[model samples]
Target chain A: MVFARARRPRALYLAYYFPPSRASGVYRARATANYLARRDWDVTVFACPMDFLDKVIGSKDEELLGTLDPRIRIERPPLNQYVWQRDARDFGPLRRTFPHTAQKGYAWTQRRLFPEHYASWSFASVRRALALHMRRRFDVVVATGNPFSSFAAAWLFRRITGVPYVLDYRDSWTLNQFTDELARPEGDPVHTWERRVTGGAAEVVFVNEAMRAWHAERHPHAADRMTVVPNAWDADLLDLPPLDLSVPAAPRPIRFTFLGTVTAVQPVEEMLSAFRMVRRHADFSDAELHIHGHLGFFKGADAALRGRLQSDADDGRDSGVRLCGPVPKTEVADVYRESDVLVFLTGGARYVTSGKIFEYMATGRPIVSVHGPGIAAEEVLDGYPLWFNANSLDPSALADTMISAAKAARDLSPEEHLSARRHADTYERDVVLAPFETRLRTLARRSS
Target chain B: MTLVDEAAKDTPGTEGTPPHVVILSYADPVPQRVLAYALYLLRRGVPVDLVTPTAPSSPTSATFPHFRVWEMKSVEERHPVKWLQYTVVHRLPSGVLNRVRRVARRVPGGGPVLRAERLARRTHRRVADLVDRRLFWPVYDHVRPLVLARASRRALASIDFDAVDRVVFTDTPAEHLAWKLAQRHPETVVDGRLDREPYAHLEQIR
Candidate 1:
């Protein structure tokens, strides 16, 4: 007699950021969801609806949804906080003052009620999760977060169904990594929620070692259960051919390129100051500092950085410090191929590693590190052959490093050229997550 | 159908008396409705006074027949003597008059430098006329609200309600002038045919 194999245990993955939303954290969430579904697990994903991510965040990558596995069931329950807009027509019972304090007050109310600080996700998600669980009970749940409210949903599901659950911290919550401060004051709702959620979890996963160490130091008893799963180079972008590196027939100037987002933390002032110093030198005359990135992460935020850059450009400090704004994903490789040298700037230290570092390494372009030396990304870029560390924030030191990188980029040997692409080949995203997948399978078996 | 003619027929005009009527309005856009009303009153044997904000010789007022046009020709006292004094002083040439004017100033008797004053008034009138000609009427209308309020106040202050049998306001803004006439001389008829923009609710009379 031919006997059928036992049915696989089901898993519910809760991620506020998933496919079709081009949030910074979406890639990590997408990789987790897609990897599990492909590994023969029944993956049901609860996420922020497509329409909500588009209107509020103003970014949507509908094309990325094509990359998702068809087997996964992604349910987008109505998120209640989304209904309450920070708008004038809807400001009920609040006086309309000149400097409107209503928006801040509304944000404060969410932080008081939920650990996620600005969510009503639990309101709709818990009800939806309960109905789904009653139909077919999930064996194990893994909740990933930035809107830590998703943690509350998974926690409630586990309590109701008596199923074991795991947690994935894509970014820190209740802990501001840049300043390394305990993000909230004592007795806040976040403090109580964090303690309760961590106490009940089967396992906790962090994206970087610095974050895990911070969490471990804060709550040592749960330290043994935590594992680090750092973000890696996008597999899709890895195979693109390197620049031909032909000397331009009539190159306008040497382009010291910085591609990606120009955030508040990326040290824009230091980069600009350093570029001005490098352009002052006779050898680097007619140098154009090309910055190809979105001015900020969100739409409205771009105006401030745009204005500052424009004002300085108008002042004529450096003749051609161009802010060549965001390029399409298809054009990103072309932007890399065009530049002589690359600038890698980050605002995070120890705990923060930007995903751009992997792509930067893959270009084999001499990268002048504009970020502080202590950032977690330093460890990744340290071994690359063409790397130039701007050891201090001083413009002169950065200028010296930038000049050396531009010169090296202009005159590259074939062996030295192969080094950048060679070092980055090892950290493909799928390779980074392979061990994490095995660990997840082990967790599922132990629970069953 | 004319109110003035019908009234004249019922209560015959006395030999020594003429039925007095006054019409107040802005001179801009010719105030065609107000002019038509005044023309009807004149045809019915009523003496009409048309108050022109600028010089009375302005073409809008001059075009009307059988009506008196009163203009405040100088920024002087409203009484008759100041108008007399203003006209008498400005009739002379200013080249020699300036020397005499400086002497009069030192002697504490410079009576407001009417020549210079008249020059300023003439300059203002010319500029106002140029503005009315060149600017789009709506663009020129920016100052009309304040001008409308002032015109209403000036008409109320200077007109004698006892002499005039009725006050006719053909524009909306002159509603204030009608109210004042009603308050000061209850016997005088106060009538404004147009709807006021500011007191639009009052115009909601069905």
Candidate 2:
């Protein structure tokens, strides 16, 4: 007898960066898409077109397209209207006369005309979401943000179709993490908009408990709806075995590899200073500080940021600090396998959590955390047997931590390494996102 | 090595080589189109080399050995105006002049000179902006090709213009360079982006 399984409820996901565009937020959106799809939720992803990502943001990783589950549906909305371009030749009449004035005009329009800055996808995204909802009646709507326009679109969908939406914060909106200030003044448009969106949302998802708690405290009325769903490492990417650290110490260079975007907030200059100190005193002269990531986010900003890193990489002449350049998502495993110690350099704080840390944890090698004290990173690296936390941002302290990490790399027992890897297995994408996925399934069913 | 690399190695870049093209791009990174076009040209027995400041971050496996990449001055070096443009693009605060003047006066024993310096900087920016708008921009546009061509001539010192059959530009900024190169070698067929797209158009599909 042939048996047919019941169809699961459908979820329409609104994400500004998805497959083809390797914006750091893409992974969170991908996780939501893949996790929901795997749990039999008929998922449709509203993603930014590849051309917009290629021409405007200038960083496109089409390889990410292959990583998506075939069961999912991806729709490209109209996002071409508000792409940022610095070329004066491409400017309008007002922009041509006063390029500086034109920039101010963009900021004004971003605040007054539409909430989405430089992202022209709001109208098109809303239009598409409405048409799709009318055609098939989406069970639940989900939107992830930092181009918080996706949330604005999701809110529009809720207003139109009454689809219970989940608001996921890949990064905080209206709350600046670096300065710990409100993104704007207390009662500005962004503040009002965020409050309205949160109050309307069925559930609000955050990357960490810190963010979730922050939002919960701010909007106590929607406290029950707020939940923390950490950005976990994709298990598929970690198919290769972690580098075995139990082998005999060799005089060869100990690769202290860091694989993530080298932004100012990550304390790259501080790390460089710490690295230079370690090289001098700790006899880590042999240790190669391999930085494998892009210099900046946009195409226009790349050269300026690269100029800073060029000095650190000693003008790409292969100093001890080497700028390895960015590697494809597929080649990430090979680089991990080659590294001896993983350097977790981040703006470590309660509000911040780098997904790279989970990927770092997956690699059983010793990790030296070169970031300020933060609960989110601390919680994740809690029981890591060979993890070294830098007590202070001081170069000397970080050097000592790096030395400790180096020592751990040389002297860890095979059992200790295996145990660390086993602990990371619990924090895999599937492991972390499963409960959140289940909650969404329940919400989708309830709405249907 | 991959098949593309193997093919590139096999292809002969002889002294008296067949007609070839050099695609010039000054500011922007290598777009996906250039990579595709280069590979297409290579496969069609046409030699193509990309002259740009930086290479594409994620090139296809096929692009490895197909075309040669010639580096140029970075955007920061080539386009110094843009460096200053981004820094002070936004409107200066209404009280900025007054605030600076006050700070200058408050500085221990160094008020007059600091205030004078601040006034000079403000005057310099205003004059520069006026000149940039009225004089430099309009004149620059008309003679852009000549300017870029002169710049390219210096940058491509090693390149043999005699052997190059075509000089192509995938974007607007480098079109002048293409035009300049085309003039020096009348025999060279220039596929200038200016002829096709005089102005940058939005990619908005109706």
Q: Which structure among the candidates has the greatest DockQ?
A: 2
Cand. 2 Cα-lDDT: 0.72
Per-residue lDDT value at A191 in model 1: 74
> What clash pairs does model 2 have?
B145-B176
Which segments of model 2 are wrong by more than 4 Å?
A1-5, A80-83, A87-109, A242-251, A281-283, A312-318, B1-206
Per-model RMSD to reference: 24.1, 15.6
DockQ of the candidate models in sequence: 0.01, 0.03
> Could you give candidate 1's fraction of true interface contacts?
0.00
**Count of clashes in candidate 1:** 0
For residue A325, model 2's alpha carbon misses the true position, in angstroms, by 0.8
Pick the TM-score winner.
2
Q: TM-scores for all candidates?
A: 0.63, 0.67
